[model samples]
Target chain A: MNTAILSGRELNYQYNRSQRQPEGGKAALANLSFDLFPGQFLALLGPNGAGKSTLFALLTQLLRLQQGDILVDGTSIRQARSAALKSMGVVFQQSTLDPDLTVIQNLNYYAALHGMSSREARARSLVELERLQLGDAAGKKIRHLNGGHQRRVEIARALLHRPRLLLLDEATAGLDLETRANINRHVRDLCQQQGIAVLWATHLIDEVEAADQVMILHRGNKLAQNRCEELLLEHHCDRLIDLFGRLTGTQTGELTT
Target chain B: MNLATASYCFLGIFKRELHRFLQQRARFASALVRPLLWLLVFAAGFRAALGIAIIPPYETYITYEVYITPGLVGIILLFNSMQSSLSMVYDREMGSMKVLLTSPMPRSYLLLCKILSTSLVSLLQVYTFLLIAALFDIVMPASGYFWLLPAVLLASLMLCSLGLLLSILIKQLENFAGVMNFVVFPMFFLSSALYPLWRMRESSEFIYLVCLYNPFTHAVELIRFALYASLNLPALGVTAAVTAVLLFAAISAYQPRNRPQRGKPPS
Candidate 1:
């Protein structure tokens, strides 16, 4: 088998007492492990408070790992943080784009952060922006664009460096149906065409396709890890939502009928 | 990374700050107006009550306006540094900070670049204030204007570091108002920015002691000396040492292990 581009080994994390508003020092994640190879899309399926974001935080180095190790393209994040971060691009759940700057301007700023030369930054920014169908709106301020377009700008920014891995933290949390599908299709196409490994986290069942790899998490524990169709076949369930309901013991509101 | 990459990163941050600063027209106007008011109104009103003395940095007896020019410059640096750091808190809440932290560079280096960018922004306002002071005939020695550049920049970096340390401690935007009242006021009022140490000693020995201990006092003294094309060794030593400590401390506060307790629940 080809070496996995992303490897998360026995990952564990817990919130401390001071961090607890009501529940303190509970395990936010427990002995979770996963791997993704190039051109693969792994849908991290979980509801609210299921430790999806906590795992994302740890993977992105936003939160330091309490226990376990994350290796991005063979570099341990703990041992070589800069090298580990260098191999991946991330789209945070919250909008990180500057609203006052134009869409292209935002891309250019991120290009600089990645240490890309001005010539390369402009060239890559245009390619990504056009691919995402954001070319015409390049000069428009971020505040002037709709929520979906802003998210697309963010995706374009993340891709400017052409990372081996792409991490999306609820990239479609709040969006119209058509926009969500458009983003979903775009990310999938990127994974296929560029051979980029994708770790997509979401609570929505529809976001997970039948052929995609899926990991079901509940209360910081992995309930299942397999292809969507395989998991459904193994559980004797007809739909992904039914399988999720059986595992997490809770119903999610974002299911697409 | 290489020097070319590092330099571009700095340029990117500088460009972004420049854009934001230019867009906020009121911010520049307000920064100047505060110091100008003190130089024109408060200094004029206090000239009759406060007598001038030939301080170490001053050659002879000087007017109240000349005496307090550096102090007004201190006020500008103090306020601007705090305001710039306050934006960090805003950025953290608004999520832009994550973008910065995620850069494929050392976290400490990224933060230093951030502080440097903001300090550069504050320096612009400082120079503007100095220019206006010069127009009002409150000019420094000829080379003093040039000398003030490095002196004020060092002073500005120290103040920005202290403000960044405070920003890490302060969790919410609502609580930053308390910093203005507590941190800014105490540093400005308890320093030689407004009165001489001897004069302060006459009023209360405790206040005098506090003024001597405050880092802002050393920063003001440094600026005062540099503006006259002279260097105060002791003041320079204190200001530089404190800046190193505060900057190191601020950078440590962002490191993964020491990062302020992030108990935010998973969304």
Candidate 2:
């Protein structure tokens, strides 16, 4: 039940603000480490600029790992990047779909990128689209879809490969509360039913549940990591907002209730 | 990479590019018009101003239209290659490049496949321009058209590789217009594209020397020779060498290890 699907050890990342001084100034992620187990929904809670997307970039092989080891299903990303990436899927914070193409076309292109046959790609894309309730819109151009629908298409595209690990970098961003809740529920159901491990990066505290495993990242540091209830108990706060405030030294009512 | 997977990657990218090219009517029109303007208006205006000595590729005196057709072919390819680079920058901005780069295939193979697909699209544009030129009675040897296919393909690959290198060096899409002006203009003007090397020499020795060294000049000369049913060994050698070097440089620039902070969040 606790088998690790993804693990990173002492991961480090830096961002040079100025090109004139490329030497070094501040690190974006400082010696970060964590593990995600099969069928686990790890809510990677962090404020903006907390290096959530940076970490996702490294895990997805969009950026080469600089200073540590990242293993996806026991395959090292540094040494066996293609093999490691093959077992993972990612939905970036930004919409990556081509607006000019139909939803099915975008999904089929992604499936082909993973070397799936045309027939397999079409069948899988339809199944995923139907699952996302986007079956009727598959033939429509992405530009015709709303923000929530576009995000759904992106998610369906990501799952077409049936990867063991799904990484969502603020996947519910820019959606209304109801739509955000729906996406969250759907992804959580995927974790439970498909046994796929998920690492959901978000700044919203409300999206987390008391039973969910949570990792609070602030300013590139892991401030807290445990079950949500445990963290609430540890910080002696019933709400995650208060716990986040106490951990990060930020007093705000942004994530209440 | 496995053969099946490689074919799939190649075909998928090719189809996507083709689809996008077809959908953007303005882009297609501009790609064709740029060369047509050079072939019809510019060449027609310059016809009386320039004189043609019997060159190796040309057994006898040829009209300016025939002489500049290959060069105009080069232009179509040059613009298309740069357009491909533009799309690369746009894809990076849209975050779609992240999806592409994260695919299970080796990055180098995928990058090469992208260049090849762009070359294929550019090849189609060249042939379209040639067919239009043929309608205007600027015909090459019957067999020259077939022979020129390989030469056009090689030149397209070389130019596309140069564009890839430029895209890697360029950091943003908003700044690419400046680069296009800086690169595309200098390469087109200082090459054998608009005028022959002898013509350039008659104007200025230094300018002629620059044209002689420009890789685009060799690519033009290569296409010219092939279009006349003869092979220019020196031009072929030089263009091949430049393609190899530029391709290596572009691949090196594309290596993730070289740019640690490449996948920055969208602004």
Model 2 lDDT, full chain set: 0.87
Error of 2 at B176 (Å): 1.9
lDDT of 2 by residue, A1-257 (tens): 56588998999877753456644646778889999999999999988888898888788866666678898776677778878877888899988998888898888888878988788889999999999999999899999999999998988998999999999999988899999999999999999999999999998888999999999888888988999999899789988888888888886453433
Q: Please, what are the lDDT tens digits per residue for candidate 1 over residues A1-257?
A: 88888888998887773543534577888899999899999999887788888888888888878778998877788888878778888998889988888887788778888888788989999999999999999999999999999999999999999898999988998899899999999999999988999999888888899999999888899999999999999999999999888876766453433
Q: Which stretches of candidate 1 lie over 4 Å from their true place?
A: A17-24, A252-257, B260-262
TM-scores, all candidates, are: 0.97, 0.96
Top-scoring candidate (DockQ): 1
Interface root-mean-square deviation, each candidate: 1.8, 2.5
lDDT of 1 by residue, B1-267 (tens): 999989888888877888888888998999999989999999999999999789888989888988888888998989888887888888888887888888987888888887788888988898888888888888888998889888888899899899889988888999998998899999999999888999999999999999999999999999999989999999999999999999999999888788744567533
DockQ of 2: 0.56
Measured over all alpha carbons after superposition, the RMSD of each candidate to the real structure, in angstroms, is 2.0, 1.9
Worst 10 residues of 2 chain A by lDDT: A16-25
